[model samples]
Target: MKHDRPKISDVARLAGVSTATVSRALSAPERVSEETRAAVQQAVEATGYRLNLAARNLRHRRTGGIVALVPNLANPFFSQILSGIASVLGPAGYNLLIADTRTADAQTLLDYAEPSRADGLIILDGTLPATALQGRVPVVEACEWVPGLPAPRVKIDNRAAAGLAIGHLADLGHRRIGHVAGPRGNVLTEARLSGTAEALAARGLPFPEEHLYPGDFSLDSGREAARIWLDQPAATRPTALFLASDAMACGFIGEVQRHGLRVPGDLSVVGFDDIELVAHISPPLTTIRQPRTEIGRAAAERMLACLKGETREADTVLPVELILRASTGPAPA
Candidate 1:
């Protein structure tokens, strides 16, 4: 009761053609004579032969797969990005492997290009060394990038986007503004922090040396920043604070409330990365909205182009939008 499956050899024999002719007919039918193609079709139907893509790819030395590595997979910020990547790769018959790199070492990143692993990689982390990425497999950096490393990248103009936040606060008549920047040594931290300072100076405003706080783009860091702000006397404390992320903004607002300070009342606040939760919080966060999904889709497409041996510029910068919501208001009277 065991039935054998039909193969390409059987189809070629039935069509009275050589195996090479059969392959050309199936893969590049336009190149074959119409009569040969028609004969191959008839033979294919008669023998019920289905092409084996795995076998063909094996012979071609292709794994038909790619990989995506992110700094933290558990973070909700990366969900839409990964979705965008799959949308493109799925239709092209390529499989995607998501790699969580919070614990990845230098060797782990370097080993991504080894044989039988993946054809290419899309890296979301920006801190990896350039030495770890020199390999035959292609790599594309998305959202964040390490300075001085040469790699194709898709990201927003961080400095200009941060400037927009500062300009908004200034427009609201806030002379005393503080900034909670991302981790030190991070490219984003340098860009946004410099942008904040530059925007302040452009408006004839001065930044107190002690007003800037270092944050790791985490909720806990935001809470700690609020405490530091509170330690200052009310007269010297900044009336407005611009945090690097929505999660931090939410934490700052929550922590300040515990000290009987209300957002936009006792202290006006602004945040970056207008995540969905920011809109539903007690006071909606007024922040810059990054096109996270767009960045991912563009990165995926760019990676595909690289795999085809196409060369591209090192940077692709996207625009950002500032959303004004309830969290920010006119400086307190």
Candidate 2:
């Protein structure tokens, strides 16, 4: 005769918790006390209760969980990206797991690849090494990545995006243009830097190395970049700044104000990654509008195809638009 399946009551009895608590610990673990949750989990594992996971997860050749890995979840820009991923996955009856690796460190990135719990991975953070991916999971490179990876990707042309930012500044008659670059050795940094150089060269302009501010894609880095720009001699200082991200641009503007400088008066600014805050902040930001949600959706679709062994294009380049706002104007005469 076939064996009857173990019940929830059996798990509760072993765990010394109410059936309700067991359910809570299993489903919404954040609601349960750590100690009790651990006990319940131990009991569930001890009983070999797969708990419908085999059927629930696609990795088990069934409907499995899919993880959307982001470097930072709190950023408002990524919130829409996550929603886009969910929008694509929810209709297919797939569960979504969101994990913020917290840091861009290689070790943390590699840790996410282990065990292959998810059938596929949508990687928003580009810091992870390609070696870490190595067939462990179906990987779709989203907005960012380390340089020189052959993995399939979905993104806008970073080089052209940077050129657009510089061109906007140049059009404002800002001859001395400064770039607050992203983190050192970052893939975005190289692409944007190259684009800035190409734009300046095409305009018969020269970009001094001193005008490149080292930033790590943070508000603090932007603040630092502003301070460095201010330190330059007034006559020779960059009349305008183009930041690599909206966060950096906000920081730069905030810092400039703290020093009693007005945006678009003392300096004309252009930023990339047209996040929501760019529109609400004082003076509003002039920025490049990235198709962030579209990128997320495209990445998800690519990963799904890879999971299904369906042949698909290796790269998809989304388009970006330039938004001119109050933050930019003619350079101060």
Candidate 3:
């Protein structure tokens, strides 16, 4: 004969508590006392009992799911952030659903935020319109944020980070500096570009329109920028460059080196986002380091708080650091 499956009643009996108490501890854990939760957990382990999430969710009127909206799933920069979110939500009995918003239309994004689909949302795409998310599920913005959304956001100071990059190059006696900017209409692109301008102005450095190269935070764009730079006269070229993303910086460096250029000796380059790949690249990159994992964890915590009716309207800004490497040096004489 087949043995019976372990049930809530078994857990309750083993923990010396009523089935009602066991149910609360397993489903809405915050409602139960710490001691009760611990006892129920021990009992669950002893009896090899597992929670029936479907039945519990139905009874509690919860979807037991959280959705995270990312701009690009293929980018390695988002990997650590997603991992941080999963670490917190997994133990809390919530399933994480990831959606790539890059190609998703407005309706498709709205559907993901529907009450029947997910209980909460973690948004990493700031380009989304505020109207799309108005009056939907509770949301916590991570890394990027929509302007005037009133949602709790966790991110680093993009402008300040940009300043750090420009300052580093300026201090190295590089008089002429150039910038590779992110796409227009992006929040980060605007912030970082403005910061670069401000830093240059503060130092009395010239930044003509020609010095700014358009980029989409992609390697291809960086390679294209490299081509443009190579076409310019050597006497007019900027001695140092600050790129918005590490991928673009690497692309620019690779392409220029192909034409027999040496980094820092011929031109110095700095990048934003100290991705893992940057450290291992040829002539390791100097970049601004963002606490990507911490941003995700903080966003997840804020999302959980919103779901629990402990909502706050505060924005959390994490710190960034300037990481020096072999990619930058004093300007060539």
Candidate 4:
């Protein structure tokens, strides 16, 4: 037996709405009321009606795809952000294409921005030059952003977030604070480093050059930082350290424990990007919680706006929270 598939008219009839309303409800949900959307959904479920997305995209001259450029696809911090992006774009009938720019050159990365490839782009790599993305497809920068690119960026205030970390430590009676900074030439690294300095200055605290350690936001760099801290004379060591990333903080804590050390008892540690792993560590990490998923969602919304020819001149800055955990405590007596 052969049965013809249900059409949009069938769905409209079942929902007691016009075919035009059904089309708008399915394709651009925001254009319709909540009750209408619910009715359309029920009608769709009852009639087993499916949209012909391929044909619709062909008629509209759209590729039905959105590309996201991530610096490191393996990093857990980015997982939630990517999930958020997918949550929105998927239901909107757009395919998400994630490209890792970790080892890609400028020219190679630029190729992904062509309009023929995808309808829009979501860039999370801040290291790319402004020239690479200037006149290409519509873009929304998430988490990280190029300095001079004329695109809407969705991120937290890195400087203020760093200040929160420093303020927390200072309130806990820790006078001499140390910082594990990210690599040079990175925008986040620069912002956070400057924030650390500004916070210290505001409190009239001394940040000796030796208290600053170089890192590349990796577990290995954290381990190396632990070694450097351990080598310093006991009397001159800072009472607490604020690491640039949670992975690095975890690595430093693990390495320090291996060499017979107690967190918060002998030394306290704070980290950024409250990733999931931090909560389960030996001494749960105290860190700055970035709204990673929200950042992604906001970025996707901005991309959609750009596609609709809407202009957003201001950047979106989300709020961050300082989560207190066992990894941080008052300065040792």
Best by TM-score: 3
Kindly list the per-residue Cα lDDT of model 3 for residues 26-145, writing each as its tens digit: 877989999999999999999999888888789778898999999999998899999899888888888999999988998998898789999988999898888888678998899999
Report every candidate's CA lDDT. 0.87, 0.83, 0.92, 0.92
Global Cα lDDT for candidate 1: 0.87
- After best superposition, candidate 3 residue 123: deviation in angstroms? 1.2
* lDDT value, residue 318 of candidate 4: 99
Return the TM-score for candidate 1, rounded to 2 decimals: 0.86
- Please report, as a residue range, the 10-residue window in candidate 4 with the lowest summed lDDT: 103-112
Candidate 1 lDDT tens digits, 1-333: 998999889999999999899999986687899999999999999999988878876986878788888888877778888888888887665788888888788778877766577888888888777677756588898998866667799999888998999999999999999999888888888888999999999999879977898798889999999999989988988999989888788889999999888889878899988777889998888999988888888889998888778998868898999998999888999
TM per candidate comes to 0.86, 0.80, 0.97, 0.94
Q: Indicate the residue-level lDDT of 130 in model 3.
A: 84
Q: What is the Cα-based lDDT of residue 110 in candidate 3?
A: 83
Clashing pairs in 2: 56-63, 57-63, 57-64, 58-63, 58-64, 126-145
Task: Order the candidates by TM-score, highest first.
Answer: 3, 4, 1, 2
Candidate 4 C-alpha error for residue 36, in Å: 5.8
Candidate 4 residues lying further than 4 Å off, grouped into runs, are 12-21, 29-42
